[model samples]
Target: MLGWALTFAVLAIVAGFLGFMSLAGLAATVAKVLFVVFLVLLVASFVIRAVRGQSVL
Candidate 1:
C-alpha cells in the first residue's frame, strides 16, 4: 500500500511537470488516500501485535 502511494506520488509529480493538471490532481489525491490508509493499517497492526504480546517489529 505504501509502495502504491509512492508510485502515485511520483506519477503526480511527473504529470504536473508535463502540465497534465487533471491527471496530476487525480494521482495526488489517490496517493494521499493510499498513504492515509497505509498509516491506519500500520497503526492497527501495531496495536494488534501489542495486544497479543508480540513484537511489532
Candidate 2:
C-alpha cells in the first residue's frame, strides 16, 4: 500500500514536470489518500496486536 502511494507520488511528479496538470493532480490525490489509508491500517494493526498482548514486531 505504501509502495503504491510512492509510485503514484513519483508518477504525479513526472506528470507535473511534463505539464499534465490534471493527471498530476489526480495522481497526487490518489497518493495522499492511499498514504492515509496505509497509516490508518498500520496503526490499527499495532493497536490490535497490543490489545491481544502480542508483539508488534
Candidate 3:
C-alpha cells in the first residue's frame, strides 16, 4: 500500500511535468488517500502488537 502511494506520487509528478493537469490531480489524490490508509493500518498494527505484548518495531 505504501509502495502504491509512492508510485502514484511519482506518476503525478511526471504527469504534471508533461502538462497533464487532470491526470496529475487524479494521481495526487490517489496517492494522498493511499498514504492515509497506509498510515492508519500501520498504527493499527502497532497497537495490536502492543496489546499482544509484542515488539511493535
Candidate 4:
C-alpha cells in the first residue's frame, strides 16, 4: 500500500522535473490518494488488532 504511494510520488516528481505538467499532476493526485488510503488502512488495522486482543466488553 505504502509502496504504491511512493511509486506514484516518485513518478510525479520525475514527470514534473521533466516538465510534463499534466502527467505530473495526475501522478501526484494518485500518490496523494494512495497515501491517504494507506494511512487510513494502517490505522484501522491497528485498531482492529487492538480490539481483537482485548477481552470481551
Candidate 5:
C-alpha cells in the first residue's frame, strides 16, 4: 500500500542519516517498488470504475 511505501521511504532516510548504506539502499528500493505498485493499482481501479460508469472520484 501507499502507507507502506511511505514508511519504507522514511526508514530509508533515517538509515541513510545513520550511515547504514546497505539498509538505506534496500529500504529505498522497497519504497520505490511499493510506490510503483500503488500507482499501478490506483490507476487500474480508476479505469475499472470508469468502465463501470461509476464515479472515479
Candidate 6:
C-alpha cells in the first residue's frame, strides 16, 4: 500500500513535468489518499501490536 502511494506520487510528478495537468492532479489525489490510508493502517498496526505486548519496531 505504501509502495503504491509512492508509485503514484512519482507518476504524479512525472505527469506534471510532462504538462499533463489533469492526469497529474488525479495521480496526486490518489497518492495523497493512499498515503493517508497507509499511515492510518501503520498506526493501527502499531497500536494493536502494543496492546498485544509485541514490538512494532
- Local accuracy of candidate 2 as per-residue lDDT tens digits, 1-57: 999999999999999999999999999999999999999999999999999999999
lDDT of 6 by residue, 1-57 (tens): 999999999999999999999999999999999999999999999999999999999
Query: Pairing residues by index, what is the TM-score of model 2?
Result: 0.97
Q: Highest TM-score: which candidate?
A: 5
TM-score for each prediction?
0.98, 0.97, 0.98, 0.89, 0.99, 0.96
**Candidate 5 structure lDDT:** 0.99
| Overall lDDT per candidate, in order of appearance | 1.00, 1.00, 1.00, 0.92, 0.99, 0.99
How much lDDT does candidate 6 score? 0.99
| Model 3 misplaced regions, further than 4 Å | none
Q: Put down candidate 3 lDDT per residue, 1-57, tens digits, no spaces.
A: 999999999999999999999999999999999999999999999999999999999
lDDT of 3: 1.00
Error of 3 at 2 (Å): 0.6
- Ten contiguous residues minimizing lDDT sum, candidate 2: 48-57
Residue 37's lDDT in candidate 1? 99
How far out, in Å, is residue 42 in model 5? 0.2
Task: State the local distance difference test value for candidate 1.
Answer: 1.00
Candidate 1, residue 46: how far the Cα is off, in Å: 0.2
Report the number of backbone clashes for model 4: 0
Q: Residue 57 of candidate 6: its Cα lDDT?
A: 100
Q: Lowest-scoring 10 consecutive residues by lDDT in candidate 4?
A: 48-57
lDDT of 1 by residue, 1-57 (tens): 999999999999999999999999999999999999999999999999999999999
Please give me the total number of clashing residue pairs in predicted model 6: 0
Q: Candidate 6 has what TM-score?
A: 0.96
